[model samples]
Target: MSAPDTNTETQHPAHKTPLAGIAIGVGVAVALLIALMVWLAYNGNEPRDASDGAAAVQIETPTGGSLTITGTASD
Candidate 1:
């Protein structure tokens, strides 16, 4: 017989590369990104409410000695 052809058709199935590795790498990256976004959403909600209802002054009141009380109230 003459020399056989050496084209792509002569390649073996065992020599072929797999597509599974590329798909798994992409799937893992997407899962991590979604988890990080959820954490940031819960963190920003609390500080906004605390700043709106803050107090500037505290007072001390004494009992029936109701004879003397001195202070100025301001708004």
Candidate 2:
């Protein structure tokens, strides 16, 4: 009695893991968050709705002879 030969050229599907997909998703989310923070920080430095102003005041000193002081005693 003769036995039939089995085929040895059949291909099997490659195995895949879920860790790679999860890592890529997390990386994208982190990159977007960092970009948003940088944009907000740059735009937050602009000045708005305010104006600059200044003011001045006058000063004076006494000029009377009776108000003057001397180091010598007066007789």
Candidate 3:
């Protein structure tokens, strides 16, 4: 018996795993989501022009009467 073969080298498969692809796709998706959130946060906070519509505030008196103060956007 020729000295029992002692080769210990590990051989990797030629085909690549899908994990890398999956990770890349997930990263891109997360990046897009972050960008969208940032865009919404930025755009959502913009000041609105009073000319767009009327603004009203309502207050209730202790006597059960309600008073509404209304003003045009130009105010």
Better of 1 and 3 by lDDT: 3
Model 2 spans > 4 angstroms off? 1-16, 45-75
> Cα lDDT of model 3 overall?
0.74
| Stretches of candidate 1 exceeding 4 Å from the true structure | 1-18, 45-75
lDDT of each: 0.56, 0.55, 0.74
Question: What's model 3's lDDT at 51?
Answer: 55
Judged by lDDT, which candidate is best?
3
- Write model 1 residue lDDT over 1-75, tens digit each, in one string: 865765656565534444456677778888878888888876754434334454234355575342433333332
For residues 19-66, could you state the per-residue lDDT of candidate 2 as single tens digits?
667888999999999999999998895345323322222344465323
Ranking by lDDT: 3, 1, 2
Error of 1 at 32 (Å): 0.4
Q: How well does candidate 1 match the true structure in TM-score terms?
A: 0.38
User: For every model in order, what is the number of clashing pairs?
Assistant: 0, 0, 1
The superposed Cα distance between candidate 1 and the true structure at residue 3, in angstroms, equals 20
